[model samples]
Target: MRYLKVIAQDRSGKGVADTLHVEFYEGDQLQRKATEADRQRLKSFSKTYLKCAWFNSGEGEDRHVRIFSHNPSADGTPETVRLHFHEGPVIAYKAAAHDLDNDGVFELILSSDVDNDGRADRTDRNRVRSLVREFLRVGW
Candidate 1:
């Protein structure tokens, strides 16, 4: 009974705008793609992708999140796998209300950078500085 929170990021690790554009990942094994429909479907998937990530009493690497095992050979049994979510930092910029699990309203996520390299260590201060410079430019 978990839902997902969608987070979009640019290569420089910035949030995406609300217009619902998408970035696709593909390989040579792929051929002519059907991305228009795929893009629409992706939004639905991304929104709930992180909902399964939850921690118990404490936080950090010790906390593990269970994911759908997708193990189907069903004689009617539940299958799941747990992964150390702390290993990868999550960047959450927004939240929304849901009655999905009846968990009462909004679900959330916090920012962390366990390794602090690829993860976004840059903060609002950096963004503010950049915007100021962009606005004060001498030439159009």
Candidate 2:
């Protein structure tokens, strides 16, 4: 029997980080589905707040959620969403592990603007380069 599940999708790629649809599932059935109808319950809901996204396994946890902004020019602008299946607060970070890079331990990937464009793309090489530079500045 399946014990845990997650569902997320990006909504847009224009300005800031927008809305995402998420849900939980068990077995082969969907337990919850975040949809437009449910979003109406919120104060401000716009199509700009929703878009398409992709998901990949992050290091150091069973799962992680990375929300990318709507900037075609910038990649690596993911708003890391921490998920804790238990009861209290659990923090999740962008990390790398042995299975991730053929290494044994885990490496943590911190948050950095990397790009000066004020937005992040999902797989931009330049943005990732900038992020690495900023992240490794050291003692500054």
Candidate 3:
């Protein structure tokens, strides 16, 4: 597994305000590690810090993950290991551009999930309409 650290501090002081430490691991195997320092230097009074990683899998497909863990084994190792799994909703999201009322330039067509199941039905026009309405309202 790989380890990373992100730190956030007050802009006018020299003490750290918050820190995020992460670890990256492959299906049971460990891979590359990353941290915010890998990106830029943090001033003693910085406001925020981020440690991110973009992992590439060798299985012919592409995937990404955000890691969060907090645990330390006295032997001098991290204490916790956790990975979150996210799957796009069934309805997914598609795009279209047209003035439903044909007024002028496109109305910025969009879609939303009405079922509230966290997934949208890609093929259902009603579902698509629901998504569009939601998008128009809050751009969700």
Candidate 4:
């Protein structure tokens, strides 16, 4: 499996300069710089989703994509969306939320990963369309 790191910040009158950084990796080694097309795709996605702070995958054996969003409040925690993939199809979707009750721990809300028939769930595919289409264009 491969990994990609995408850095994007909100620039919608937030007094922040727009910037994008993309890098691809195979294993622990950097493969190469992102192409112009890859940068464009990330830019377009970031434009549509201004809350996106950054997105990347875990190192080594992790085969998932994590998208981190900006926090709305200064004292609030940011949300993270994870797309778990097996082979190529996205098998699970998970969202981590801030602690609403002022607890020290955060909360993780999971979408159903399996149906009654024990098959991988694809219902959340639409929710992570950008990752599937732009990054991993397989098993769609």
TM value for model 4:
0.37
Query: Worst lDDT window (10 residues) for model 3?
Result: 45-54
Tens digits of per-residue lDDT for model 1, 35-82: 575555454443433232322222223332212111133433222211
- TM-score per model over all chains: 0.24, 0.23, 0.20, 0.37
For residues 78-124, could you state the per-residue lDDT of candidate 2 as single tens digits?
22212122111243323211112323211333332222244444333
* Whole-model lDDT values for every prediction: 0.28, 0.29, 0.30, 0.39
Stretches > 4 Å off in candidate 2? 1-15, 27-29, 40-140
| Highest TM-score scorer | 4
Clashing pairs in 3: 10-45, 71-79, 72-79, 91-120, 91-121, 110-132, 111-131, 111-132, 112-131
Output the TM-score of candidate 1.
0.24
After superposition on all C-alphas, the RMSD of every candidate to the true structure, in Å, is 16.4, 15.8, 19.2, 16.9
Clashing pairs in 4: none
Model 2 per-residue lDDT at 77? 33
lDDT of 4 by residue, 1-140 (tens): 34554444333545342554555666667676567766555655544322322222322222233333333454544333343332223533443334344443334444333111343345433324444333332211
